[model samples]
Target: MYKSQIKIISVIIIALFGFILFSQDLEANSMPSLDYSIELQHDGSGIVTEKRQMHLTEGTEVYIVFDQLEGSEITDVFVSDYDEPFTYQENWDINASREAKTGKYSLIPTDEGYEISWGIGEYGDHEYTVRYTISGMVRQLKDGQSMLWRLFQGRNNLPPKKFSITVTGPKYFDPELTKIWGFGYDGEIYLEDGQLVSWSNQPLTGRNHITVYMQFLDQPFQPTLSWDQTLAEQNHQALENNSYQNEDDTTDIVAVILLCSFLGIGVLIVILASIYTAKRNKAIRAANPLITGIKRTEMNEGKVYREIPYSEGNILDVAYLLQEHGKGDMEAYFNAFLLKWLKEGYIVQLNTNEANGDKLKLTVQLLDSNTPELEQQFFDILLSAADRYGVVDTSDVTRWAEKNYDKITELKASLPYESKRTLIDRGYLYNEDVYFLGNFRAEVTKSSYQGEDLYNRLIQFENYLNELLSLDRVNLQQQNINEDIIIWASLYNLVEPFVEKFQEVEPAYFVTHHFNYSNIYLLSLYSSGFSSGYDQAVTSHQTSMGSGGTTSFGGGGGSFGGGGGGVR
Candidate 1:
């Protein structure tokens, strides 16, 4: 009886093992893949050629879905299996038997989206190339142009084992200016050979889709579809909790040391305190004049003005002075506003936790304060950039600036004129005749007698701030250096150097004083980050593909296109 039972068990094990091997063989043979090449025309139309390697058994047809087109339409669809191309059937019977539907395709328009269906054509393993043209694939945004598309849906019944997408536009995609991001599947996307290419790394299973978002600084195609709003900000926000967020590579060495230390707890506390001091000193050293890349105005030492130029100490007036005479760029204008806001309690900087890895991170809160009557609009714009919690961060500012580019540009263009108007009202500016071509002339706004005197005073004040970098602690103390003077120095791009000098003299200046050295540093960092990072972040797009790390086998929200197909 025991021998008979053993023989039966052996037979059952062999059968199960053979079945497992057979299933693996079947899966290996049946695995499918897709490659998409999209060529975008000058008028934003797209010619998409999908090369699919699929294994078919007794199935009658295969199909692809397109939805959320936003008035876009698909046309000129052709399907081939490297043999005779398939014929278009006016009314494709999806329920037809495999033999009846051979060498035929059709476009079925549903209320939700369109399905492009094609026959199997006696396939075991077949390479099918399906071509289609989509009108208005790219859209004109309020600030720029963008293309947001989902090549396929996550809920695809037979998701491809692998997929590749290559997109080419009317113009070469400049790597520095063109932004591309992929969502919904584990893959890599990059600009190469004047085009954008993306591919999947893993075989997609339950709810794995492919969505792509692309933007161009210089429009590569003239878009026909128009959306009267920017898509970048919302797209960026969608990627915040995704893998695209900046990764923290630093390990907690201190924690490891504490865990392994045989020393007393007091020693650990002392070590922590020393680390704190070293970090503070490091931040101060980082504030060195040479490290602050902003160029300062060079002035004659003898003409250094020790007094403030404008009694009111308006940042706008200082901005005007810098724009008219000093080496101030758009950054300087932003810095001037930031510093002024920081000093007058219009904006308050919050302390960030270093242990949380947000060291030197800048965050500000917009307070309810009455702004300057002349600059009320500017303040309102600033407020518009803040979040629901009244907090302002780099991302918030970047998004606001990108979306309101025209509004901000118009406001900034009016600054010089507004400052001049204020000066004229105060009897410091006048319209004067200027010569052109030695025959014609135009009356231009210029400094009057009083304005010229005030300009000299402003130059002298800037010179004084420049000299502070060279002065010793004792000599620096002699100069009337107040918050107002420091804030005004930002106009001349001297605030960074001033911070470095102050750090050198009084190491505890930030600690003991109500003054915000951090505000200056943070705003400067914000400005630099904005110029580069903002363009990259706020102008890009995203979809909910993964949850911060692992693959999200759910749905892809915030993307176009829906549904997917398999051999039916």
Candidate 2:
């Protein structure tokens, strides 16, 4: 009887061990996979609707990752627009659940990078795109959005994040008809039917919630360092102690040889020689003019020699020349460089991998698309810089560019576009082209409002300029050849009485002309798609209450982003 009982116990124990090993292997090789295909349809302008649902019974709302979907556009063909907007069209407004109810961003948190979504479409197919142009490499929804976020621990360390969440279509999605999309990240996922409702426990690197998200692991969440040095040191100490306790007292033969090598005369001589040579080369390179940048390139290369015009006092000219030459002085921009470039048309690179511990690449191109001429200019510059120092494909130029671009872009966050734009209007970019530029500059003393409140009161002044630009638009509609007469009059501070005629036709608040310069607001917004959301994404940074009651927001608010907020 005793022998029979022992045999039964042994079989049970073996089965349990086998089952444990199988489960361990299964866990080591699995992750959640998404299964929907994306579709983009055009025409059939009757109207279209987009609906989103939250499936978790306890959860009130959910967030979708955006920015990754660059190059794609969304359109609200026609939706029911109630008295109040139903869909949160602007990204700035937080998502509010009508049912359970609470306003919160579609993206609450994330281990890294935001997961944003928007109802995108073509403006007759021309409303610029932000998509997966760099899908696998250098993550960013588009230009301004960063894919550079990092986490300290494993994935799922933080909650999900979102940016530019849009739900356009007032008449149709005015109040939004809701539905549940899927269960929360914690619901059980049944692979057999593919109907799994499981919470996404994937903590991204850099967050501390990995322990809470990953439930099945018997061990604690590992530190995000990928390899924790402190823990490693502790483990190594324990190992050494154990080895000491179980070993022979004498040192091993291999250890003796390594010890002698650490103090050997021959090794010491080699170390000294290498250090001396490195220092000598460093000194020589510093004094050599050929190693500097532009001047050196001109002396060595013979294919082309176009000297950039430089300016003396103005900083704008210096910035423009540095960007063009591909190799030159790199410290001449304040918020001035980037703001000017973005408004006109330029894209700067901020990727770290491309920034070889150097400057940034401030690439300026048309916002519409890349032209062949532009491509040639870029490649030519890139190739020239590489050749100048035998950095040939070492990625030195691009590295410098990416860092420089990133710094300027971040700087733009604090600058106002008014002063920046005016500087360009008067022709400051040419100052540096002369000595730096071909000699670009405009007298600030002769500029509007002088430098007293150049930045603080720029938007209002810009409004005036826009109105002047509007005079040109009238020439487009009515062959009024006297267009220059009206424009010149406005520039010289004499258009007050001339603009009163436009008050009756514009929206109530937009009327009632104030200063000699501001009627430019409406004209500017109309051309730039700034006044309203009907045709284009108009941005006005300053919140204003004008004649009838126009509440203007985002008026060139000093180098702000397009994916900043919702438009009216």
Candidate 3:
């Protein structure tokens, strides 16, 4: 009888242990994603909305921290799961019952900043959308307007699997006069349709926070709080080691003009300028016509380059060059490679029953075409995600990427290296070792051409493609479209616009070209879907413990917010 009882107890213990292991495994595999949107008001306030889709294994609540918020007020805090609004609790209890904590939130003030906390309802998966208004978000500097803010805090265990931030400035915001820079992570931040959009190229982990600095040269705001320093001075000090400086520095230009004026040499300066302008025009006129034949506009001068820089550049080469210049990212590389393969007959997109307006999910089937040496690994990864029928879909790609996050990250990190090596071999780039006072040695990569002519040519190529979109149907049809151009368009995140333009001008273009899509919408869907899947996969199952590549002190210095919080 004793033996039988012990056997039953051991079986029960074994089953419980198995269950515990299973739960831990599930939680380990699942991850959360956050999407944040901030709209800046003319009054210098910002309305921030955080949409967090979380997978919770434990903890009854989660919270966000808003620290370093002196002179700033956090108000109108609201949290909901789209089903019902959470009631505001003046005093939030951390140890409350799941039933008691459900549909409740609290705003607690800390010595540093405010803590916005909400109940997690029951565990598993939950979508929590939190909204709050931050007063004094955009400050008025003595010389210009400035906004230095942190979107996410580093060292928070709850690192988002996939995250994106969309910051919409005032309607009258001018991209030309406003200079923006991003810090604290490896990502690309740029102005899109007058809005500043930023996203993580790789998964955010460890000390990788999100912070932005926007300097408005036109002084567009009338905020109550004022800073003593000029925005330019503050920007210079903040962006000491950061790389994403997109604006041209006019300090030297202004100084040179002032000195020439003070010296009463205006006529001499004008003659020199004219002579230089004449030479520039002569060089431009002597250049061969681009394949697109898009005429360069004045706006393209300095801001946009209208020609391909290198003679034997491919999509990967261009993607690498743009990335080195902070104008491209992993998303560009991912989309470009996928589309390039499809165009080269290595894969075929099959329409599925799924449809969303003009967009449709595409099932990709591997073709018998020989894959290029540079593309073989990526192709093999896609094949690994394929079903027994030798087909892969968007979902499959996402799943495979999630399961093989390290592989994808390593592959992406290798692309730039490979492209750079190719360029170096071609004499476009070379390494030069520099010594600091004849003691320490550092090898700095140098471009062969003066004033980054190769990079400018890429910009020109991009400008040409952009100009093509605005052309009339007749003019558009007169231009030739090729696989390389399409791949570069994907890198530029203009595939959708290009597809729309093609569809509007000549729907027959897709049928005639190597695009292999009967419906132009399907091509657009695949491009978007592939990008989305790749992002979702890379972000999943990534821990907050990263390799410590934090640049928090660089551009994000003196930024408001950036305290850390998680499930507690």
In the predicted model 1, the residue pairs found to clash are none
Candidates in descending TM-score order: 1, 3, 2
Tell me how candidate 2 scores on lDDT: 0.26
- State TM-scores per candidate: 0.48, 0.17, 0.43
**Which candidate would rank higher by TM-score, 2 or 3?**
3
Location of the lowest summed lDDT over 10 successive residues in candidate 2: 208-217
Which digits, one per residue and each the tens of the lDDT, describe model 3 over residues 150-173? 777656447776787888877745
Q: TM-score of model 2 relative to the true fold?
A: 0.17
Clashes of 1: 0
- Greater lDDT among 1 and 2 belongs to 1
Regions of model 2 farther than 4 Å from truth: 1-483, 489-497, 501-568
Residues 93-186 of candidate 2 have per-residue lDDT tens digits of 3343334232222232223334433332211111111222112111112111111111111122112221111111112211111101111122
Report residue 382 deviation for candidate 2 (angstroms). Answer: 37
